[model samples]
Target: MKNIETTLRNVGTVSLVGAGPGDPELLTIKAVKAIAAATVLLVDDLVSPAIVALAPPGARVIHVGKRGGCKSTPQAFIEKLMVMAAREGETVVRLKGGDPFIFGRGGEEVEHLRAQGITVQVINGITAGLAGITSLGAPLTHREHAHGVLFITGHVRPGDSDTDWRAIAATARDARLTLVIYMGVRGSAHIQEELLTGLPASTPVAVIQHVSLPDQRHALTSLGQLHSTIERDQLTSPCVIVVGDVVRGVAAARAPEALRRIA
Candidate 1:
């Protein structure tokens, strides 16, 4: 038992880290420690440059960017690099944007590491969905307007079943749930169409782009005007789409004629 414990102690560890939104100040104390102590960092595309600068001067930094609709480093290659580094007795950190577990593919990386007998741990960070809604000074779930909150993805992996937006709209309407959709910009029109089948055309919605960053922008509109609003605002990928009456919770989201101006 003592010998086994000693052997494990000498093995290098891998930390799956969440880099928060774009703000470096949002970093957790533990995340900072892990990053500062890292020997190698596998950084995601959306991770803030400021956060990457937190690594020790001698620490190796490698960008393994994975973005929607863009050329990116292959996931298989990234995982392979992690395993190689850990077995070579290097402390590896996989830095991802937002919370590691929230659609960051941290789970798949963790499984791959564990299968290779590498020690791994995950440090939590603020998810973009929460940050995006909060940036608008609105709660995802309001006791009066929303009783539940659904954090769903607008994108799906290959060979995986696609999301049923219409059915989701039906459930959200009947249950008074708020929907936070990530990676949903390209599909906004189709989502809006299906959602309108079950939800009201006038349902309040907010599309927040680059949430928590200096370039952050948002537009408040109705479900019926979602796609048009996104187009008019020129909102692109990496945006969070908050749908439901909870959007109306924001003073800026409220309107006399039921169409608050988009920014």
Candidate 2:
């Protein structure tokens, strides 16, 4: 671990560390050092508790977590917590699951902190796209098969928002590009319906649940049956949805029995 000397000013600094996808080894060295040196730690629901245990002793670990279908701490409150801690001249580390910048709302926290004259550091981690793809032995970009790749979130509303999954799906489908969708587990059916407006029904899709963790499971199905397969398999959160020809390769190599863990 690198020596992290958090020089505290009148307004202290916040280090945003990405915890990666349920695997501590995937954490960057900077993230490890930030945790070891933090005086205050704020964590999200997606972050594993084991990762939190790695923080230095006597560090204040606050669970300002937000998750689907659960009571979550408001974004404003989380920012206020960081601001208050920093104002006290404490070195705060805001830890998030996966890459802080990738759909983790780390940007919002940074903007809020900067507005208050607090310095922030962002350490990127292994996002679910890379981890899920690697777990399935599928590459997002392949010279012969796919020239480009697209990463989108299933939770984003279509059109005019900060991010648009529908538009990206249309463009990527038209170009036959690989697509990776994060947090698309519950919305798998809706995503399938929307994506079919752009891509063929036969387009291959893979739903990987609990990727890179023990008891990981995946279903390789067509764009048309993707949602049904997910429901039949009883796949849950912490899953990654992939749509493209690359899924066909995964289907061929991955045994059918391997996907039959649950329902």
Candidate 3:
């Protein structure tokens, strides 16, 4: 173990780490230490149990995860917990899924901790888009096929119907680009419909559920059949949806490898 001086210099130090999609092996070395040294662990809804098991046996673990249209732990309470833990001179670890700042409200937590004079450190991990696509053997950017990629989230507030569907659809249609959608299950039906206006229904799509985990499943289908396929497959939350011609290539490559692994 390193000297206490190295770890204790920052009295109310809080490290916010991205836990990746669902694979424990994907955790960074710094993130692992933060977990092992944490006096308290604050986790979001999307974090998996495999990662949480890394914390010291006696460390306190709290869940402050928020989901759409559900009763969520108040953000104020979560911030207060971090501040209180730090004031007690405890090294705190706030674990979030994917990149903390990306759609994870990690910025809000950091802001709150800083306001309370707590030092914060961030450790990045493979986000869902990269992990999801890689698991299916898909490349978001290809020199020959795609020159760029766009990441978007489908989760939005009610009454906020304003969106740039045309812009996104146009890119998908005209350019060598791939579109990755996070938390997209709820609005997938509508997104597919809107995309049809700008892109072809024949475009390939892949939806990955519980990515990188043992139970992870990926379905490859066309945009026209995507909604129905998901319904039939019974995929749930914590899934990533990718749409583009590149999806077909990924499916073609991964299907045989996945089958051989199973065999």
Candidate 4:
């Protein structure tokens, strides 16, 4: 009777996989394998269709869009779906864009999944901050220019206090840290103002959009000109904002031949 009871209950695992940026080729081997084996996949809004095709034809794909400043699937509902799918013995893959831990709300998902007693795994991928900066022929940390880096998010939900950009600017200036801000386009005006309190108005800044994708575009300017640069170039969200001396000289970095450099 115990044997029969044990056999009657089937259990499955959940893998929280990062799809990297938009490039399908950037997916890790493990991520690819997990994706292919998924009987149920909950994909984020930004995941590339090309990567989604790695899954077999029979696998179920559910889009749970989560773009900033846009209507998105409720986080609670997405968590509930994960728990439901895993309990049904489906090989569940919660595919997110970029490294799951880097402002991807991956930590929240992991805690919720574990609380529900679902076995979970996480696979790392190159985050947009890293990829975006590199695409400009620049490095986040340079011995002479920057000693450390900070990856921050610019979005502040209603009722949430705004970030202390003045404080961050002071620290970044004194500590030689490079600032990589995500979802920051909307607040560029305010951020530029506060950052100028510590960082020089002439400090270098670059905004890179759709990093790692074919249509990627970036604008290089100074801290004082951040808002103007974005306005002039029509830069939008789903982008990263880089600031500090590390961006001072990227015009000579080796980039794809076709990429156009703008200021």
Candidate 5:
């Protein structure tokens, strides 16, 4: 881990701050301070507008949006913009949804910045998977059901690197672990088939969308029906899919009133 405090003294420093999972209240005090002090704010698509509003007046707020399977600002361009702004003695804040280091490409950005001799600091934020499971009333790690949890991305395709979801499924079964998959909605069908090879068909599953937000919604199902459940519920992107016995805990904990309302 790079020492952030030592880098802060350098001029034109850049801070990579995690904006948390679609909720302004989830922002860390350190992240908030960095946003307030930023001279240039580079925002991601999933970052809540309420958080962006916290930037200081007269700050240059640029929307360098990046969404999977959608038109996005090129990564190289965004990196160049950040480097240019910092070289001009601006405090650049690369604000992203979720912890930047977790599949947010924070490491790449940090490497690019450091290569340019730009001072860089990182501030952690609550990732969507953590927020999503908690909001659904699920304990990620339950000693009785799940001894541990695995965070993986479900965006893998056939031609992509060999992720070996089957092997992971076998491990999860043997280890009694929960699997939290980010960006799993689009690839749920394939992921379900792969996991079903090792895991039982009846493994509990939960798909949470827009977690922690006012309009958040989720669906609970079994691994065998994961794809069907998503299709039937009309669930879309920006979803977190959890698979394991731990999901049963979330289903069991559903408030009676909430259940009645849904019914």
Candidate 6:
């Protein structure tokens, strides 16, 4: 090992890496490189264990759980830990699930680190909403079905104002867009009701759980039955909820197989 003073002076770098949607193979080559070079890793709860295991055997791994609606390690604390580790001249990696910029709080971490003059690099990974829908063979945006796609978080921060779902539903309906909601299972009923005011009750909806994993499961339902389907299927957190005409493609694609079996 290098001398402590030399190590401290040479080290001090932080990489904010996206671990992707629960698949180790989905990790970007740059992300893997950052992991391999890390002397300290600050891992988020949603990051897959397989990716975490890629860290060097001697790297210190710290779990900074940030799951929604659960007791979480405070963001400020996590930021402090990163600063501390990096300032000590250790190569640090803040591993988060999905693209750090997309609802991953990666921006905040980057801001905090930069404020303290720490050098930080970002490595992008596939987000769950994108990966989840594709896993079902549905495109997020199709020229014939959807004009665009919107990604939103289902949970509102505590003490903050709630999202105007009614307005969003109207916009989505008018824009012919696909809606992908993350961290939405708990408030699914309310979301379904508000969306119904704008979207047709027959609009296709898909709830994908454990997306891209070996045990992944999904359910297809209409807007009217979205809540009921989730409850009946016992779908829980870490699921992606997709709504809009893009889902029709999933049904249409499966129809041929279904008809063949029937025949």
lDDT of 1 at 105: 91
Worst 10 residues of 3 by lDDT: 254-263
Q: 89-121, model 3: which lDDT tens digit per residue?
A: 888898988888787788888888888778998
- TM-score between model 2 and native: 0.88
Cα-lDDT of candidate 4? 0.89
lDDT score of residue 41 within candidate 2: 96
What lDDT does each candidate get?
A: 0.90, 0.82, 0.82, 0.89, 0.89, 0.90
lDDT of 1 by residue, 1-263 (tens): 99788766777889999999879989899999999999999999899888999999999999999998999899999999998888778999999999999999999999999998999999999999999999887899888999999999988877998799889999999999999999999989889999999998988898998879999988888888999999998999889999988887675555544444322
How well does each candidate superpose onto the true structure, as a TM-score?
Answer: 0.93, 0.88, 0.88, 0.93, 0.91, 0.93
* Candidate 6: residue 195 lDDT (0-100): 91
Off by over 4 Å in 1: 1-10, 252-263
For residues 1-263, write the lDDT of model 2, one tens digit per residue: 12233334356788889999877787888889999999999999888877899999999999987876568898899999999999888899999988999988988988999998898889988998878877877788877767788778777543645445567778886676999888888787778887888878888778888766677777777888888998898988878888888766665566665333221
Model 5 lDDT tens row, 1-263: 35565454445989999999989999999999999999999999999999999999999999999987889999999999999998777999999999999989999999999999898999999999999989877789998999999999887644889578999999999999999999888888999999999999888888999978888999888888899999999999899998888777676787655333222
| TM-score: model 3 vs. ground truth | 0.88
Badly placed stretches (over 4 Å) of model 2 are: 1-10, 157-166, 255-263
Cand. 1 TM to true fold: 0.93
| Model 4: ten consecutive residues of lowest lDDT | 254-263
List pairs with backbone clashes in candidate 4.
none
| lDDT for predicted candidate 1 compared with the true structure | 0.90
Model with the higher lDDT, candidate 5 or 6: 6
Q: Which residues of candidate 4, in runs, are more than 4 Å off?
A: 1-9, 254-263
Backbone clashes, each candidate = 0, 0, 0, 0, 0, 1
Q: What's the distance in Å from true for residue 25, model 3? A: 0.7
